[model samples]
Target: MSARSKKINNMAYGKLCLLLLILSGLSLTIHAKLSSNFYSSTCPNALTIVKQEIAKAIKIEARIGASLLRLHFHGCFVNGCDGSLLLDDTSTLLGEKTANANNNSVRGFEVVDNIKANLEKACPGVVSCADILAIAARDAVVYYGGPFWKVKLGRRDSLTANRSAANVFIPQPSFNLSNLTSSFATVCYKLYVVLGLCGHTVGFARCTSFRPHIYNDTNIDSAFAKSLQNTCPRSGNDNVLQPLDYQTRFRFDDKYYQNLLVKKGLLHSDQQLYNGNKADSLAKKYAMKQGDFFKDFAKSMIRMGNIKPLTGNNGQIRTNCRKPN
Candidate 1:
């Protein structure tokens, strides 16, 4: 072909790619119409129902709050927070709940079930499971002393769960700084920063998740590693729990960033934020100014919750969170 023809073809291809992206964006969110008062008319008690269930669970075990928040974050990564992560494994579908990243790590399904049962009773098919999950995460953060933001709703439940996507999208505890940044991309590294500071502030990691850090990693403080080594160890006790923040594991604060400043991060991925990188400055700022961290965290949560939500006639509203209708 002539060079002029080739140039025309390339320009046409570029235009086609851009047009496809534009259409994709419209299909995903053009009709989302998410708002803080989305449920005021349809299900007035939607947020309240979710908050009550989360509070009841947190009352039983404070760590359950973290689990719910984690559920929301993980769900956002794969297929844009369509509640696919909540689906139970079945003969026809290998759901995300059983995926490598979520298998034994993610928890608090019972609390979600309780919330869904109540929501169904009050307003059957009015609220989407994805929206409930997002609201539950916000309520958990507020109940645990983190910043509160109005969670926009209107998302619909995904009909199918992509287990393969779950395994690939969710960031692992063993990731380094570069991995963390790239994994948290599209939404920007700031999402990683706020989550690392806010989520880990109240969350805990499993012994297996941090064993490599406490044993083989050199960046961690010696005393901190030694202490964790006692709780976690070189082998066995895989389910043993260790607080992400050694000082205050139940409070959602900037102390998780502070811990990183002293090389006391509980997981290999946690310390990556403070280790001579672009994220180091962010970690330092949050460590020194917790109010700023809280403010940014609240904003980031809202932004993260809105990514590519299924709306309009795109997805269905699942009655039971464990399965689609």
Candidate 2:
């Protein structure tokens, strides 16, 4: 054909390709908006109700596991909590068996899987498994009767699981304040900032219907309880106990700060959160601000869910959550 005709055909094809690209971009934008809207509208209600369901499941599972004396892992990876941590490597000779052990993390997954099944029935694949983990973590907190705050959703799962990440991320229950601060700092969260953040979730969880059972008292009746009565005399009544002591046991109360005033706090790391005149002032500020705490909790949960997620077939859907390939 003529060179002029060929040039005209090439131009037409180029224009057609550009048009298709534009259309694809627009479609993606619309889909993303719709997904966000769905997340906003459905997440809160589903989270609230599903949290209770998860609480029930975990509690029942915990009770059963306690009778069995099983150990469980707690906390999440940057992306979200993967129940795989609960798998018992001892159960199989070559790590090819199904994970059926009972730990809080495993129970939490069972609870979450139940929630996932329900959400799938309600909204199909719209809700991600990672969001279920976020909601279930809160629910697990509630199941242990710790605290139940509103968890923001739409978290994507991690394609890769990290045992090293687990080692790095999970805070030691008995960690000192400085070490705890370092743990938070690993994720760019400062200790003072974290204490403020904790005040949001911890205070709300305590004040609400949820309760957490705190354990390990090195000097509860002796030194810790005595300090409680000395600080905040109005709130501190008994020499052995105070409103603050109650805070440690109850996850849904502002008493954590109150308790901080008493024994100085449950975790050795927690003391740093309230130490120093500046930290003391921040603690007081957090103690007085309930609404601020709630708002911060919502924001933190949303941020937590977005950490290093796997997308677009980067991760696989395990037929069994406990068994990893």
Model 1: per-residue Cα lDDT at residue 185:
50
126-186 per-residue lDDT for model 1 (tens digits): 8998998899988988998888899988999999999898888788889986565556554
Mark the regions of model 1 whose C-alpha exceeds 4 Å error after superposition: 1-31
Question: After TM-score superposition, what is the CA distance of residue 105 in candidate 2 from its true location, in Å?
Answer: 7.8
After superposition, the stretches of candidate 2 with alpha carbons farther than 4 Å from their true spots are: 1-52, 55-107, 120-126, 137-152, 191-245, 248-251, 317-320
Every candidate's lDDT: 0.82, 0.41
Please report how far candidate 1 places residue 182 from its true position, in Å.
2.7
TM of each candidate vs. truth: 0.89, 0.55
Error of 2 at 89 (Å): 4.8
Residues 85-109, candidate 2: write the lDDT tens digits.
4333542322211221111222334
RMSD of 1: 6.5
Question: How many steric clashes between backbone atoms does each model show?
Answer: 0, 15
